[model samples]
Target: MVVNNGIANDARVIKTAAALRRAGAEVTVLGIATAGGPREETTAGGVRYVRLPVFPRRGATAAYLRFALARRAAHLVRDPRRWQRTLPSLRWYQRAFTRELRALDPDIVHAHDIHLLDTVARTWPPHRCPFVIYDAHEYVADLAVAGRRTRREVESWAAKERDRISDADAVITVSPEIATRLAAEHHLPRRPTVVLNAPVRFDGPADPGAPAGPVRSLRAEVGVSASTPLAVYGGALSTARGLGTVIEALPLVPDLHLAIVAVPYPHPMSQELRELATSLGVADRTHLIEPVAAHEVPAFLASADIGVSAILGTAASYDMAMPNKLFEFLHAGLRIVTS
Candidate 1:
């Protein structure tokens, strides 16, 4: 399996890997290395994860230095080709992934998103290529981009997916709506399999020494008494999530406390939400918690009074999708309040 970002916080990827492992298949997930994380590690379940670094180095510091130098060189050269000059670091990672893929020589290749769809398709000739699975986590073609991507770039992604999607032996997506759209748009032979972004089922209490550690209740973690009314939202902090709406509405329900367990905390959006809460005189009732481990989420959120998915109609993708946090909340036994 291949993904563009670090795999630590991706619940979908983690769950998929675990399921495949339980089915007696060997899985190796190739993902981009994040700062201060290991380049390679094996999970407790024995699935191997290889994180391709942007530079050839064992230490994160050295890798960052080399990447910074490459970016500096790209600026100095000021090449007319925009991609070549602006994305030297990305190119390095791509080259590294390609090299790693060749070394693995697996029987099946799973491309996690459109970013690596073309790369995996072109890795080998059609006659001897592995059975490829393209997993679309979102409706990439019509995904909402907020100032981070140009229209041309978004179109290029759509084109890339359209071009290489036929090469995939099977396709998987997070929602039924996305699966139907993919088949219609790409003219696939069959609708892609719908795999809702659900949390892993728990048959019993997790072992104490588990990777996630003992389940820590949200109220305890946030230093709130058991009687405190807590509404929690867990996932990426973005405008698309309509978090600002939640913060703005806090004043209406003065007794209710909202906790946002956001990935990559101290994010710009989280800061903005905090400021908004303060302006509304509900700052004390708002809590910002760093994201918990993927396996630990349901347990961690079990004690919260409510789970909120205030997703805004910011884009077509957001409107047609089912957010995974909803399922996590269900598994945790929390009542849901969604938009």
Candidate 2:
């Protein structure tokens, strides 16, 4: 059971599934099936994908228009109506998710995150689905819900996460921090495995046409003139990511332009960040680009002086939360500053 077969940008699942198949294991993805996925439903890689209804998201192509108009996309879903509208879609995703997994009859089922734990647990027949692994991507339990949800809502989600981690044959998390916390917080029979979310070691062709002339051309296109240094921040602009710090850091450097290449995670804080940049009089130097794919990251990182990854010390952050953006920065041979 590939619990996180949800998004194309979810490169971990995709790569893992492919890797498993290449290693002589048959893999099936229980995820949202977008138009971009192989139409045959199963890839030649011995990997099959089962589209979960709840995971209906527009893929990279649809991502093109995410930030448009005088306004870019909203970074957070702060409105009440959005939640009401989102509930029905959630139900569909659940139903589609359960049916497909049940049909797949995987020997070992792995659910990626606390939200899916209960659903997977209920779906698994007693003594069947022999191995259930609760893969905690982040600490759902510790997440401070934003905008409107009550403490009860958070408690319910956290409880479910706890149950999932406790009940699974094995609990797997991305970092030691989450692993240690899970060990202390739950009644798991044994310790959960900690698999750090490191970036794939790049073995691709070096310098894929990203040279000086093209780099300068990109600089010119984004209004970053020859004299300016570029401080690039890539990836989600969520509250947890600590993007405000990046904006605040901008005021210290007069000869720099801030290039943010990310689809702002839905939040009011993101809008506020933009406003903060404007208030600081650095808004003119802000170059906002939409999200790029995992593979295309080096190209994005190429136009930067330093890459920033600021995840304010969440325990759920398994082992320093080695987000690939940090790795991409390293791969692109750019300097990086993180918090």
Candidate 3:
């Protein structure tokens, strides 16, 4: 399975790999190493995980120069199109990914998301390739695009998807809406299989008599009492997430406390949210907790009174999507409050 991000927090990838492994197939998840993560490791489920660095560790001066350029593209460049077009890191990762794939030479290759299409295509030329499954995590073409240039960037991805969709032995996606759009837009022979981003439903612990581990709680983390009406938002801390709106509404519901459990805790957006909360005079009620592990998410969120999906319809993907957090909230048994 090929995904761009480190496999540590990617619940879908981990679950899929585990399922494939249980079915007697050896699974290896190839991805790019996240900040401070090990390049090579194995998951508890016994799946091999290899994460290649975006930049080469030992290479010629030109390679390092290209790495510098990529870093510049990431930090200095404001235009998304220019960032994507000029960045060499994607191609560098592609070459490294293709090399690892060649070494493994698995019978079946499952490429996750549109970003890894080129990597898979390079590894196995269409006609001669092994069985490949394309997992469309989102409607790439329908993603939020700001200007004409960014639209062109999305168009390039659409073109790539259009070209490669036919080559995939099977295509699966996160939602039926995305599946329908993919078929209609790409002129596919058949709609992709719909696989909702639902959590794996297991009964209780394997040993029913065994003591349960201490469950993390949003209320406990936020230092909120059992009676405090805590609303939890667990996902990316971004403008499109409509968290600002949620913060704004907090002033109206003076008694309700808002807890955001997200990654990259000290993020610019996190600061922005803090400022927003302070400005609205609800700072005391707003809490931002660092993200917990994927396995602990449901139990962690279970202590909250409500799960909030304050997604603003800023993009087509957001409009017709079933976010993983929604299912997690359901599993946690939290009452849902959406935008």
> How well does each candidate superpose onto the true structure, as a TM-score?
0.85, 0.71, 0.85
How many clashing pairs in candidate 3?
Answer: 0
Off by over 4 Å in 2: 1-6, 32-50, 55-94, 147-150, 202-227, 264-273, 313-320
Q: Give the alpha carbon lDDT tens digit for every residue of 130-171 in model 3.
A: 888999987887776642325646665666677667778889
Evaluation by lDDT, superior candidate among 2 and 3: 3
State the local distance difference test value for candidate 3: 0.77
lDDT for each residue of candidate 1 in 255-288, tens digit (9 for 90 to 100): 8999899887666686788789899999999999
Error of 3 at 202 (Å): 4.2
Candidate 2 per-residue lDDT, tens place, 19-39, comes to 566578877767665533432
Better of 2 and 3 by TM-score: 3
Better of 1 and 2 by lDDT: 1
